[model samples]
Each structure stands twice: as C-alpha cells, then as structure tokens.
Target: MGRIKPQTLLLQSKKKKGPTRISGTTILTCNLVVGLIVLSLVATYRQWSNRSRSQAEDGLQNLEDTDAVKDLKKFDLPSYAILNTSKGFVFVELHKEASPEIVDKFLDLCQKGYFKGMSFHRVIKNYVIQGGDDIQGLGAAEDWIMKGKPHSELAVSPKHEAFMLGTSKAKGGSKEFDLFITTAPILDLSDKLIVFGRVIKGQDVVQEIEEVDTDEHYRPKSTIGIINITLKQEI
Candidate 1:
C-alpha cells in the first residue's frame, strides 16, 4: 500500500499493452475465417445446382433431335426383328419416334448381348410372353443386368388399335428390359406397349412358345431361355 516504484509501473504498462494488441488481432482473424467458410458453402451449393440443371437440359435436347418423332407423324412405322432361341424367332415394327429414349435403350440392350441366356420368367400365351426379367432366378445361369431409364408415355391416338405395340403408360415403361405382346382382343388395352417395333416375320416362333406347358400364371413350367437376340433390317 506504499507509493509505486518506476520499475513496477513500467512493467504493468507493458503487460496491459501486449494483451490488448493480441486480443484485437485474434478477434479479427476469427471474423475473417467465419466469412470465408460461409462464402465457400454458398459457392458449392450454386455449382451443384447448375450442374443438375445443365444435365437435364442436355437430355431434353437429345430427345428432340432423334429421328423417331420426326417420322412418326408421317405414318411410317420403323421396323425391327429379333431372332430368339426359346421363342424361335420374332419380328416387330417399332414405335421408335414416339418413344425414342425407351426404344433406344431397349435396342441398345439387345445389341449389347444383355438378353443372352436369360429366361423368359413370365411367358403368358394369350396376354404376353413377358421376358427380359431376371429378378427371380439365382442359379448359375442367372445373369442380372440393368438398363437405363426410358422416356415413353401413353397417348390416345385416333389410329389407336389393339395388337399395335404402343408406348408404356404414365411416364413410359419400367427401366427393366421387360416387354409385352398384345393378345387382347381389338387392342382395347387400358395401357399401351411402347411400340418401338412390330413383329413382321416370326409369329410362328411366338406360337411355338405359346404351345409350351405353362403354369396357371402363364409362366412356362420348364425354363425357355433366350440364347441370344439378333437384330436386322427388314427386306
């Protein structure tokens, strides 16, 4: 409680000044760091959104440029045929223009040997010999493959008729490789098969498959596997 010496006073001043400068610098550094983090987050979000939008636009553009839609209005249906082993052989005229994305995906899968050695798990005589579905079998013969999404939607046309392979209902058909044939009378199906192509020459093969012994659900008793599918132009 006596008077302060000069040396003590000098030391006290030095301690106070050092701490004040350090505190100011630390506060400024923290503020700068917080601002930089917020800016980085904002940049990342904007980049992600822009990339998604760009991809969607590109997809739409591709559909617009395809030949299927351009020729559909001309009343000329594009054709395709398949040589299947179990079903013998089959031919189909495609609804190419109407469902370009879906049809292209189907055609691509067939060409890439995806349907080789795959069994027609759902073969219905009167309804459809639905195949290209491999979800059930687990044996060594099982070969599971995935096809990309398709873009085909059902449409009500004045020329609507049964037996015509139409596009799938709602937003096209499933991404899987499943296909259905028309066995219904007068083509009064509530849903349309995406008619990428029509059967032109292989109705006999379809008939042979129909003759096979089938379950109550129309699934064949013995496995009728598709050995390979070959596509070609019509004569």
Candidate 2:
C-alpha cells in the first residue's frame, strides 16, 4: 500500500482535533451564558420581592390610619349642656363652632363627673353666677388651662352677654375650674374671660341661682349644689 500523502495526513489530523476544540468551546460558551441568565433571574426575583413587601407594608399602614379616622368620626361634637341643679334644670348650648377647644374641655370635664355635687360658690345678683368648685368657697378643684399647651392668647373673643359662660382667672394667673355665667352684658370682662357657651333654655333656673344669698366674698351662704351635668350632642 502506498503511503498516504503528507497533506492528507495533515487534513485527517485537523479534522480529528477540530471536533474536540469546537465541542469544548461550545460547552464553555453555553456555561457562561447559562450562568449569566441565572444571575439575571435571581436579581429580578429579589427586586420584585422587595417591592411587594414594601407595597404590603404601605397598604397595612394606610388601612390602620383609615380605621383610626373612622373611629374618631363616630362621636359628634358636643352641642348642649343639661345641668341638673338643686333649683332646677338649666340647659346651655355650647359655642363649639366658635371655641371648639374650650368647649371640648368643658364637655370632657362634665362627662367625667367633675362638676357633680359641686356647689355654686359665687353668686352676684344681676351680674354673674360662678360655680364648678370641688370644695365650697375654696376655688375650683381642677386647673382650667387648655389640655395640650398654655394659651397665652385667647382663640375667640369673649362676649360677656347674658347667659354667656366665662372662665374665672385665679389669683395665680392660671385659669382654674371657677366657671361663671353672666346675667347681663358686661363687655369689660371680655378680654380676661373665655366665653365658651350660652344659656339657650332654662334662663329662669339661672336667675334663681343668681338670687342665692352670698357673703362679702361672693361665696354662697347655703350650698347651691349641682346634682349632675351632662353633655348632649345635637342631631
């Protein structure tokens, strides 16, 4: 047999090696591409997961806020005061529209039974009738400062007209529980007093309270007790 040509031998050797090299290169390239695809998939999954978690938390927070607002809306604003006094019942309408904070404080106090069985310590005929004292003639039991902060200035201007409620300032310059109702218009006390309500019904009972005998200090001689005070919501 004739020996194979050198070119033929070379060609046969190239064909054998070419297949192995191509297979190895194809495998390496495929591995690289597969690895890149896996990494991209993982990155995309992580990003989507984080965004979903954030959206869930935000939705929960908004739901909680909405429930809180709904709960707050359940109670209507206090509109009137039904005072069961020793003399008779006196009904006063709160000026919640004008002085919301002050009226709210007053209603809160009344609801907590703070004014129950308290005496009308001060009664000045044709002027004012002051009350809401825990101890008779000793002054108010609770301080009358606004709930959150000390308001150095007034929110609403006081009009000390007949049946208008006023906050009597204590000697220490802080308003205490001493509340008063005017029998007639006295505009001079407007700057110092915070008028929160006015008597809408039962002015006769207030007049009777004003007629109660008092001493030189304007404290009542006999106990003019408040049996109870209740807040009523309009509509």
Candidate 3:
C-alpha cells in the first residue's frame, strides 16, 4: 500500500461539495417575500371584486329608477300632497287629470322625499312663494333629465291662478323640482310654466311665506324650509 502525504490528505479533507449552504435567516426571508406577494395579489382581487359589486349595484338602481318614473307618469288616480313647511302645514290637491305628467313628477318627488329640508328660495310679496331650489345640495344628479323628458323647454299652460302650485316663472324653469305657490294671479309670464296643484288648505301659511323678508333678488333672507312632503291617494 502506498502511503499518502499529509498535504494531500489535508487538501482532500478541505475539499467541499461545491454547494452553498442555506442559512435560517435566508430561508425565512424568501418565505416572507413569497407570502407578501400572495397577500398583495389577494388584496388586489378583493378591491376589484368590491368595485365590480358597487358598479353592479349602481346599474341596478338606475334601471329601477327608470321603471319608477314610468309608473309615476301613468298614474291616473287623484292624489294629494300635504307639505309640512317650516312655518306650518300646507295642503295641496293635485290636478292629475289636467296635468298628468306634471302631477306625476310632483308625486315622484314627494315619494322620494326630495322636498324634505328644501328651502323656499324665492319669495315675492303678493306674487308667489317658491321652493325646491337645487340649493339644498339636490339637483341634476337626481337623474332629473331622463332620456325621454317631455317639454324640456319652458312654455306657458292654462290655469295660472291664486294659490296654485306650479313651476318657476324665471330662468331654470323649475324642471319639475323648482316650484311656487301663487299669492295672486300672475298672467304676465310669457314663458311656459305648469300648474299641477291647487292650495286646498293653509292659505295663511302660504301668505306668511310670501310675506317673508326677501333680498333684492327675491330670495328669502331667513330659512323657510319644507320639512317634508307627503302624498295620499284619493279613492
């Protein structure tokens, strides 16, 4: 047997397998990176899912609103609106037969509680008391201008008389949202306005509203809000 040199034995003993040994810290760091990537993917998926669900809900709401408007337009039964104002309650008898579209618009607004907390923006002594200005942070966003809106432009209709509830007489012609109660007969309006209801009760309340202090622009100085408007179907 040949005897090996000490140096040769030492070199053979020092030779490694040529593979890098993994430390616990390195393994833990790799695992944490993989876990972070997984968590990020999960979070993104959930966010996208939530956004899709919200979009679907909004689309459904729009479709239902369209159906509701259709139902309101075809309404024929006599209805009444009891407007609970800041000062007092005012009763109005809706003339559905005379102005079906206009009356239905009013009814739709009432049903949606759109008039709650609305202020009387315009007040004219012995002229009219107006409310439903989009000023209460309510307006165009309400889908007010639908695809098939009839009589979008302002034009006059018959039956403008005292105590009548109808559209505004000026610019932004009410769009079925802005409304006024006539204190006296106003026939000088060349622009078309609607008269959908007649004041059946609370004439004094109407008078008080009309007589309230107003700025030069006819806007009420103090808040005269419509607490709420309730509608009832007449048999």
Candidate 4:
C-alpha cells in the first residue's frame, strides 16, 4: 500500500459524482406541504364567496320587506288588493283615504281568512257578481250570505261606478258583506250601498264573472268565488 498525496485525494473527490440521494421521506413531506397550501387557499376562497352570496340575498329580502318606503311616501300611493278568483285575478285599488273604515275592514277580513272559501252566490250578468259571505268552502253554496257586522247600522255612501265594490242590506236585513264587484256603472245603488274600492285591473275577469249563469235568485249556477285576497302595503 502506498500513501496517497493530498492532490490525489482532491482529484478523486472531484470525480466522485452523481446527484445527492433524496430520501423518500423528504419527497413525501415536500408534496404534503404543497397539498396543504392548495387546500387552505381553496377553503378561504369558498368561505368568502358564500358570505358574499348570503349578504346579497339578505339585502334583497330587506328591500322587499320595506318596499321602497321613500317612493311610496313621495307618490302617495294607496294600498292595493290582489283578488284571486276562479275566473282570474282582479286588482282593486282600495280607497283607503276615501273610506278608511270599510277599506280597513275589508283588509282585516282578508287577513282573518273570513273570505277564504266564500263564493259569489249572486252572479247577475251585465250587472255585478257578489261575494263576501255566501256560499261555503268552494264545494257548495250556503244559500245564505254572511252579512257585514250589522245590517241595521248605516254608513256614509260613496259614488257608484263600474267595478266599484259596495254592500247592501239583505232583504232579510241580515245579508251582505263587502258586497262585492260591480260590472257596470250603477247610479241607483249609490244611496243603497256603501262603496269602498274599485277594480283597477282584470276587468275582463269581472266581466266573465258577470256573465256566469245564475238561478232565479241570481245565485250562480256554478260556484264562482275568491280563492284569496292579498293586500300589498308598506312593511
């Protein structure tokens, strides 16, 4: 054996060669770190997106609840009644200012489900279609009307016109409710009944209702009724 020189040792080390051996543990740890970083980024982005969408939906719901209060006040718009009937939907603009008592009463009744299944027992063609308290649950006619609180008590009368809603005392003195929609301009009933509102839209529905055949007492041969009445007003 001969002693190797320092220069020989240096040259041999330089020739020694290939890449450093990276262990399996090191490679796996590095890949796991990168995967965790990507997963964190994705979670953060999803949370942010969900929060933004929830905020947008809440904003829209609040807007609907208040319904542009500033605009309603500025325009002095009255509340509306959306009357849903078998024929179709009829929109009535309530005369809240003109007759607050009756208008409120009608709205109260609607809220109470008092007219839920009430029918237009009296459907006189070319004149009017009456409802409010007659005819039971869309299934059969009651042959009797549920009159307004007291037929004996009288209220101030309003002008009569086409599509106007009014109520009259029954011949038995216990009949009539909101009394219902008019299909034509009736001048005679001005003093006889109290008018609270008028149909603003769906006059065609009212016409169709007016044309429904009725029996001798003007009771509709087929039941025609209010499925529901919804009031739209400020929150």
Candidate 5:
C-alpha cells in the first residue's frame, strides 16, 4: 500500500465535513416545517372558537327580540287611558318622554275604543288590579297581543314591573301599556312604576272603584266596563 499525501488526507477530511453540514441543514428544515404546521393549527382553532361565540350571541339576541324591544324603529308616544268600571273611573296618564315613539303607538289604540268592555284580568287585593289582557276580556278586538315592549330607560321605577295597556296593530301587536298606580308615597314608587302623570283630581274616584271577587289568577269573577275616556294636559 502506498502512503497517502498530506493534500489527499486533507481532501478526505473536507469530504467528511460536507456530509455533517448537509445533516444539520436537513434538521433545520424539518424544524421549520413543524413550526409552520403548529402555527396553522392554532390559527384554525382560534377561527373556530370565534365562530362558535358569534353563534351563541346571535341566539341570545333572537330570544330577546321575541319579547320586547323588537322593532325600535316603530316606537311611538303620548298614549293615554281611562278605565270607568262599576268600581269607578280610573284615569291613567302615561310617560312619553322616555319612550315617545312607544307612547304614541299606544295612544292610537285607546282612541279606537279597543279596550271597551274589557274585564279587569288581574287584581291583587291590597296591591293592584291588572286589566288590559284580552284573554280576560280587555285584550285586542281582532288581533293578538305581541310581546310587551322592553323599556330602554325606566323613568318611573327601575324595579317596578308595571306596564300599561295598548292594542296590537297589523304592523305590530300591542303588548303592554297599562297603568300601575302606587299605593305608597312618591319615593316608594321612584324606582318601581314610571310615574309619568298622577291623578291630580280624580284619584279619590279611582280609590272608590269596585273590586270583584278574584281567583288565584286575579281574574275578576264578574264583568267590568270601561265607560269612556277623556284626555287633558298635565299641569
């Protein structure tokens, strides 16, 4: 065997180093591929999560739309009512400032005798008597009452759940527009019933109104008549 030259030995060493460099390059390329795949997976998961959340929110909004605040663009104001049953006449003045659009829509129903001969649907012995539900005889003549309007801002009582009476038109069904008077003082009703207008003179007349024998549902055992309605400006 012949002895190898120094240059030949050096050339062999260089060839060995080339293979190691290629191996390192291969490892780096594999790492880069893995990183890109991880990034894509994370992005896809985030997009899916966002879509799921959006769907949940849309479902909640649909439920709310069916109740109140459905068609805000169609809100009106200045609706009023006077219930004159055998018990007596109970005049109700509405608050139109907070929801002027909703108020006007209710007033139109009252002007049409839409609530005539309706029975006091619900009455709480020392608390309240709710009449405006056609199911009890005070509801809409031909149309059905849609869900009540959700209030944007409660000027009367934040905690008060009282609503007034109104009829449902073809465009929209009137849900709630009935008056709820407070037996307590002004401060007591501050956050309960939206006290837009009080009975300035006929309050005693309302106090003297008749109350029928009620069942658990507050339904009057007999019939109650709402004779006539008169409108006047608040002083």
Candidate 6:
C-alpha cells in the first residue's frame, strides 16, 4: 500500500478521540441519573416507615383511654355483701363498676342495720323473692332513692344475670326500698329495675326462700326475715 499522508492519519486519530470522549460523557450522565433515582426511592421509604410508626403509637394510646380499660383498672379489688337471713346466709357480689351509685346506697343501708328483721314478704315461685320493707306488709313502699342529689345517673337499666339483686321504682317516680332476688333469668325487667349485686354463694338458701308457701298476694305464709347484712372487700 502507498504510504499514508500525515494529514489523513491526523484526521482519523481526531475522529476516534471524538467518539471516545462522547462515550465517556454518556456513561457519566447515565450514572448520575441512576444515583438520583436510588436516592429518591430511599427517602420515600424512610418517610413511610416513620409515618406508620407514629400512627401505630397513636392507636395504642387511644385504646388505653377507653371505658373498658378504666373499668378493668377500677375493679381490681372485689367487693361483696353477706346477707344473714332467717333461713340461712347468702353471699352477694357487688357490681360496683356497673352501678356505683346504687351499690353505694345499698352498702350504706346495710351498714346502718336498715335491713335487719325485714321479712321477705313477697315470694313468687320460680320468679323472685322480694323484701326490704320495714313493715311486714307486701304493698307498702319505702324510700329507696338516695337522699341528696344522686351521685350518678339512675341505673334503672340492669346488666346482671340470674340470682341478681335489684330494686323497683315506685309509682311516684322515686325508687322503693323493696329489693328482690331473681330465681330465674329476667331480661324484660332489666329496663325497669336497678341491679346492684349478684348471689355468689348460698344459692340454696335463696331456693329455699323461693319454695316457701305463699298467700293470695304471693306473700310468704311464714316470716323469712333478714337477720343482718355485712360488707367485705377482697384484694
């Protein structure tokens, strides 16, 4: 081949160098774009993680503020009332959490011997055994309403099961001192009665009281008096 010209060789060298410079510049630009994309994705993930963590913490705090949690904390200790009846003694578990005002009034009456010698005048077979009237009469009503302004709203709605103790409202809109223990489940009366306690022991005594002979007005033929009432607390 003929000897190449210096000018031609120089032109060819310049063409190769131009392409190399362009390739290097393109590679650097691509690397910068990829780096920026990776940085943006990492920042977005971190923000989402932080937000999720904050929401979870707020949800936990809200759960702690619920009424159920407060009730659980308040009723850590158990409270009860012991009814010494002429037939036998019956143990009652007070539902202070469900009806605080009613329970307090019942406990106060018990401490003051208000229930002593009060006979179980009304006895309905398979229904209820009611007492708490100072007089041995059946229809005579006593003031069961808390004396001053009520400490809380009237808990006329019951939330108790069988063998629960409750009071009735008199015709004059005031609660009566007459109290009753259910011999069976009574859901219909829940809206009208105020439940304060439930029988935890000596249910047989209640059964015996229920089996007593009754007169035309469902009054017990023989006296079944409340000898005394006492309170207890368990930690």
Model 4's alpha-carbon lDDT is 0.69
Tens digits of per-residue lDDT for model 3, 140-225: 22222132123333234445467888864343435547877877665643134567888999999999888888776677889987
Model 4 residue 96 CA deviation in Å: 0.9
In terms of TM-score, the best-performing candidate is 2
Off by over 4 Å in 1: 1-79, 134-175, 186-188
On the 0 to 100 scale, the lDDT of residue 202 in model 3 is 94
Of 3 and 6, the candidate ranking higher by lDDT = 6
Please give the lDDT score at residue 230 for candidate 4: 80
lDDT of 1 at 224: 84
Error of 3 at 45 (Å): 58
User: Which candidate has the highest lDDT of all?
Assistant: 6
lDDT of each: 0.58, 0.71, 0.72, 0.69, 0.51, 0.73
Tens-digit lDDT string for candidate 4 (80-192): 88888999998887777677666666776778877777788777655567786652322222222222123234343346467887665342234235466766555545655
What's the best-to-worst order under TM-score?
Answer: 2, 6, 3, 4, 1, 5
lDDT of 1 by residue, 114-223 (tens): 77887766654454455665333211121111121111332444223323443344333456565545432223333334555556666677667767897765568998
Q: Which tens-of-lDDT digit does each residue in 84-113 have in candidate 2?
A: 999999888887667766777777778788
TM, every model: 0.49, 0.58, 0.54, 0.53, 0.41, 0.55
Superior candidate under TM-score, 1 versus 3:
3
Tens-digit lDDT track of model 6 for 166-188: 87644223344767898766554
Task: Give residue 174's lDDT in candidate 5 (0 to 100).
Answer: 45
Let me know the TM-score candidate 2 reaches against the reference structure: 0.58
